[model samples]
Target chain A: MHEMALMGDILDIIMKDAESKGIKQFSRIDLIVGELSNAMPDALTMAFEIYKEQNAQLFTKDASLHIQFEEAISECIFCKTVYKPDFKISICPSCHMPSGKLISGETFQVLSYEGE
Target chain B: MEVKLNTNVLTNNNVAADYNRDLFHKTKTLVINVMSSPGAGKTTLLEETIKKLSKQYRIGVIEGDLATEKDADRIRQLGAKAVQINTHGGCHLDARMVVATLPEFDFEEIDILFIENVGNLVCPSGYDLGQNHKVAVLSVPEGNDKIPKYPQMFMRTELVLLNKVDLLPYLDFDVETAKEDLKGINPESTLLPLSAKTQEGMDSWYSWIDEAYQACLKQ
Candidate 1:
């Protein structure tokens, strides 16, 4: 859905960051997409592929997008138990209380990019 | 050479959100970000909420839509200053877009700024528009499964306005089950059943807004 907007921003960031570093082309780009960020990796990769094919000046010939998905984590308020949610179910197994606080999982960041 | 740039992809949007938050704090304006699925009676709820609260508070609206300015137009017809941010096929409204529209409103005269986010449950929940409260409108027609199906929306929001409740009798919808489902996902969140069309259960919504406005004044 909104993966296109995210991919657009990712491409912009990469191009600007790479340009400042005097890197003409990137051999690889590494991204860490949090499970709770609501972005689809397949859609992001598809957008990257399309952008790479169209915008030749922005990347090298064999540049690849490496994505690592981080599991969404939440914590129980009552028992203070931290757990990874199964299919976005935020609940404490021990106390059967909802994990009202989300510790992490809405992270959309570029970890690093390899370039010449 | 591999560069070590552990940068947030949404850094720009986050920065914009921070800026908007600061402005709201300075103005002491209570901002509410309203989100829901398409055709979930979000606009209708807002229109009703405005009709009830406008006499007591100076209200301004920021309508986010993909194509037209219809929602903003509706708010303007109610005699409130409204600015529309058309994403032009974009799925959601970011903080940057909200910041760009700030100049359109005279913040000093406005008491409440209600941002009706684009009618999508998933993408809009992820973006923070620097609002004091995030309210999700889940109409009864959307079914009982939406609370569990779209947990993120209910999880992020502090209040869930169960709109279109007048149709509850005709439709096979259970208010109690919806409340239970929301509790499983977001225990801190409160579910308020109301119908904008029939003005049923709208007083609770008005009271919530009044309390939010009072809280904003304290800050």
Candidate 2:
């Protein structure tokens, strides 16, 4: 899955940044994953565990991944009704139109990491 | 020590994509990234497209596959320059992969460049290859549930080429329902039904490309 590639990129970013900050080993990683971000959090956790196991030298024995799941929220442009969207393109319940513009739940980023 | 790094996981890919976008804009090349599920007739559509448009414009193609030069060879058979990028097992083509292949084509000599992305409905929708437009091909055989099931692909693409309309009479694919579902997911997207085999309704696709090429020159 692409989650492996996304996890690889996450590790690459942290490793490069951690080196510059004089961090020797990572203890934890915090990621903000949105429901509509195209990345599954469970898959990301599996990938992180695999990377942690393979690159034991860089991570602490108990190094873990913490994902903050963001719910997908959209606001209808026609009615201004806020609701949870099942998909990126959602129909507003109030307006019954496909005018809901996503206001949140598309974020996929590393919020922070603990090391050294 | 806790490092506060608010960074995107796809930052590197986005940076490379921006770089590729700059190059495409500078060269005035109308780049179209065509994506679809496996066996959705992407190559056949490209073959017909090249045949129709090559007389007036110099076209180049970048074919992406898990592991094959077959698509590139097909484009080459049409007498246009084509380069193949095999992802091995990678689900989709990233921006850096496209950057790696940029050296093979002289953009100045190419008026239009079509990037045929790996035939996957899921992974390819997430990555940006710095194309002027992203188009998805959905065949009638894929059924009506595809538009709703793969909203991300339809949401990101500006155009959806509904291929194999020639087979529509034999299948239960509802064109009206497909259009309605697409609208619910992405109202801005337009779906054009056509048969690459029969060459029916291909004129609209060519006109869209002509308009896109004209728009590219203005920018």
Candidate 3:
């Protein structure tokens, strides 16, 4: 899965930043994953475990991944109806038009990390 | 200590994609990233597209596969410059992978570059390869539920090429329903039904490319 690649990129960013800050070991990784981000949190967690196993020296034995899940929400451009969207392009319940603009739920970012 | 990063996980890929986009813009190349599920007739569509447009414009292709140069060879047989990128085991092609193959082509001579992404609808749509347009090919045999089933791919793509319409006579695939589903998933996306094998409704695809090329030149 591409989540592996995404996780690799995340680690690369953290490793670079951590090395510069003189942080030798990681205790946890915090991430924000959205429902519409096209990345699965389960897959990301699995990837983190694999990477932690491979680079044992850089991570604590119980290093964990913390994912803040974001729900998908869309607002109708025509009717101004706010509702949870099943997909990116959703039909407005009030106007019955596919004019709902996504307000959130496409984020996939690393928020912070715990290390020393 | 908790370090505040607040960085996008795909920052590296996005950066590389932006760089590739700049290069394509500078060279005035209309790059199209074509994606679909395995065996959705992407190669066939490209082959026919190249054959029809080669007379008017110089075309180049970057073929992505887990392991093979067969698709690239097919394009090469048509007299167009093609470079194949074998991902080994990767499901999709990233912007960096595309940047690595940029040196193989002389962009000055290439008017349009079609990137036939690794045949997976899910992963390829997530990665931007600095293309002017993202097109998803959904064959008739794939069923009508694909649009709803794989909303991520359909949502991000601007165009859906409904290929293999020649087999529509025997199959239960409804074109109108597919259109409605796509509209529900992506209101702005247009679905073009064409049979790459029989050369039916291909003119519209060629015209779309023509319009896209003109639009690229304007920018």
Candidate 4:
């Protein structure tokens, strides 16, 4: 019930499929997860499951669900260069700076979907 | 054969974070995420640092704690713009929270911003708070073994402030092994052992700030 409120925010934008056929059933979803965003995969999945039950009358028995994530990359706030760090890149490889304002990698986006 | 749906959950938040990033770049503000275990001298180091650099550069601070605005008040008292984000029960400050609070500070007047992350070593490291760098403090009382026990914090940091060194002689802390593990994981990291309370090695700490600040200017 609580998730419906939160999901309502994300769902409002997701339902604006003006060009494609209306979402008959959701097959999968693509998401961009910034390393800094606090999107717990477990919590979101549980939330989605609850939403599915709430609107159970709208879906088929075999409708599938898949979630994909994109790694968030940060750009240096000072140099205006993307902090293309190796997951192991500890500091700024270019300027030897310790940390910079995170430019990206704190995201939650639905890139595209294969529904209906 | 084709379905196109473009949506973003954190789009609004990301828009603000990007705007903040652009502001930092345009103004050449060096941002740092300062994190540590509770009582590890992060605030003490910051207080001492503000006293030294406040005259040369316009400094600001975003204090993130589970509760209390005491740290924010301390920064403001020291003559700096301060914003406090009480996560309430959350363990760390996320990018959204940081972005949401940017309007509270005058970014143009600020040359540097210290994000005093909640006194945590784990989950805080996992979240990005729009900081320029991640700086971690490990006080002697907390033991140097913290490097290996909390490898991610040490490994991700650009600088590691081994604070409370004045208490080294009174405790069983092993600086040698700590250095070895830290260097092994991140050899490129600059390590400065000092006492924030006693002001020991504050120069090295200042040197780091100057260096990072200069880099921002150059960029």
Candidate 5:
């Protein structure tokens, strides 16, 4: 939802700052939500639809939303193991000890998008 | 002619988060976004933390919940600057929400800012609120199996607080296994166990805050 809200805020600024031809149609919206970030794509799409209907003039109110999901993967420093776990485990499969370092999925990203 | 516009949806919020992060860094204040399941002792820990650490570091809290000024009101009574950001029905606090409340406290005077996120282990972990650290609290009363149940929340956390330890004597929890699973998923994460009610072993938490605060000073 942060990403979605952030996008909304950005769209507002972009529309205000660059008043080129306004919006016609929109295309793909690639989102890199880590396997861990519990964001619902369908819910986001629904919210967007409502928002677009309300402010259709500023955006491509009829554009289709396409989402690309990114999974969260962590590296085990102790055994140097790299794997993706079910969104329910926090430990290395091989080593049972807690780690001294953890790197985020860095999976959070908006790969790209295009207007219709 | 049809125009094809390539734009990133999250571009604006990322910009704002970057801005918020820079602001935190400039002020040399350690911002910790705290999250957990509802009834997971966020208020208990925040209250205890303010009482103990306020003398050494100026602490401020940005409390997020579905509805209520109650938490914010409680923090204010502790003599720390507190601001309430009600999500209405949202699951967590995003960078935008935190930025909205930035004007409430003097970041310059604060050594640490505790953002008590809405009580949910899942959604909040995915959103970055421009903080130095993300701390997760898991109360023992909630059960030991929470580690495997909510992996992402524990995996991304900088530190995990195993609260309500005082109730351990009466529960069927395997503290070791929970810690093991937690370590398995997030090995480098700091684990602190204590009871907010009994205040048992809370000194470690205070020390951890001090360390995080000092690191902020260096930045």
Candidate 6:
């Protein structure tokens, strides 16, 4: 639901980074989101579509945005066990103790962007 | 050309949060960001807390809702400063929203500031509003599955206030199981059982606030 706001930030970052590099336009924007981050990639893509249409002058008119997801993985600090829970339970499979230290799947980052 | 730019999507939010943190530190204000599912008794608990702490401390509240002045009105009825932020349809209140409300508070006169985040188990936990502590409220009727189902919320908060404990006798909810579940998700977090309506087991909450305030002073 907050994808619009996040999309706006993503655009700002892309624009700022592009300006610093003296790039006129980019052909693709690559984004990475984690499963645990609660970000819906479809919604984010929709938001970027609207944002891109509104700011056509900022980038190549046909540039596309792509988002990749990272699966959520939890690690048990007690037994050094790493596993993926069903997003409902963080209990370590071996120890049966709750472990919520997430090593991945919460990544929300701009991995890269292609330029003309 | 492909430019590899690995940067956080929420960098802007984090920068705004840091700004709010600096202001909080300079004013020596104890700010607590409270989160929960809707109807989890967050506002009721805040109302009672304000009434009890008003005599000893000057309190202010920043109420975040989709659209409503009702919460701020309730806090104002207690004769404390309360400002309301309407997110329209937004699920969470971001750091910029809190920064915008900073001027509304007289930081020097306000000893404590409570930000009642927009009620939702998932969204509110991700954004940092530059508070001293993050507290989550869970009620008896919301069921035990909430703690595990919404692990993100419980995992991030330091304290979980199990509200509506007075209804324990009528409901099948187990306080011990809830406590154990919270420990499983967050071993360092504390689960405090209390009923805002009955005012049962509120002393520990007050003591916790007092200790937090004292720690704020030292900072």
Predicted candidate 2 versus true structure: per-residue lDDT over A1-116, tens digit per residue: 78888999999999899889898899999999987788999999999999888999989999999999998888999889998876436689887988998888889899999999
lDDT string for model 5 (B1-219, tens) is 233334444456567778899999988879999999999999989999898888888888999999989999999998989999999888788788888998887887888889999998887887778889999999887887887887778877979999999989998877787777776667677678998889998999988888877778887
Better of 1 and 2 by lDDT: 2
Report fnat for all candidates as fractions from 0 to 1.
Answer: 0.75, 0.78, 0.83, 0.36, 0.40, 0.75
Q: Model 4, which residues run further than 4 Å from truth?
A: A1-115, B1-16
Error of 4 at B157 (Å): 1.5
- Candidate DockQ values, in order, are 0.68, 0.74, 0.75, 0.22, 0.36, 0.65
What does the lDDT read for residue A60 in candidate 4?
47
lDDT of every predicted structure (CA atoms):
0.88, 0.93, 0.93, 0.72, 0.75, 0.90
lDDT tens digits by residue: candidate 1, B1-219: 898788898887888999999999999999999999999998888888889888899999999999888999999999999999999998888999999999999999999999999999899999888999999999988899898888888888999999989898899999998988888777789999999999999999999989998999999
Model 2 ranges with Cα > 4 A deviation:
none
Candidate 6 off by > 4 Å: A59-62, A86-90, A97-100
Chain A (candidate 3) TM-score to true chain A: 0.92
TM-score, cand. 2? 0.98
lDDT of 2 by residue, B1-219 (tens): 889999998999999999999999999999999999999999999999999999999999999999979999999999999999999999999999999999999999999999999999998999988999999999999999999998889988999999999999899999999999988888899999999999999999999999999999999
Q: What is the lDDT of candidate 5?
A: 0.75
Candidate 4 at residue B68, lDDT? 91
**Residue B117 C-alpha lDDT in model 4:** 91
Q: Which residues of candidate 5, in runs, are more than 4 Å off?
A: A1-23, A27-34, A48-63, A71-84, A87-116, B1-9
lDDT of 6 by residue, A1-116 (tens): 78998888887887798888888777799999998787889999999889878877766778898988898888887898888866434578898877647788888999998875
Which parts of model 3 have CA positions greater than 4 angstroms off? none
Judged by DockQ cut-offs, is candidate 1 incorrect, acceptable, medium or high? Answer: medium
lDDT of 4 by residue, B59-176 (tens): 9999999899999999889888889999887777767788878778777788999999988887676555556788999888887668877755776787888999998889998878
Per-candidate TM-scores read 0.95, 0.98, 0.98, 0.71, 0.82, 0.94
**Model 2: CAPRI class:** medium
Encode model 3's per-residue lDDT on B1-219: one tens digit a residue: 999999998889999999999999999999999999999999999999988899999999999999988999999999999999999999999999999999998998999999999999788888888899999999999999889988889989999999999999999999999999899889999999999999998989998999999999999
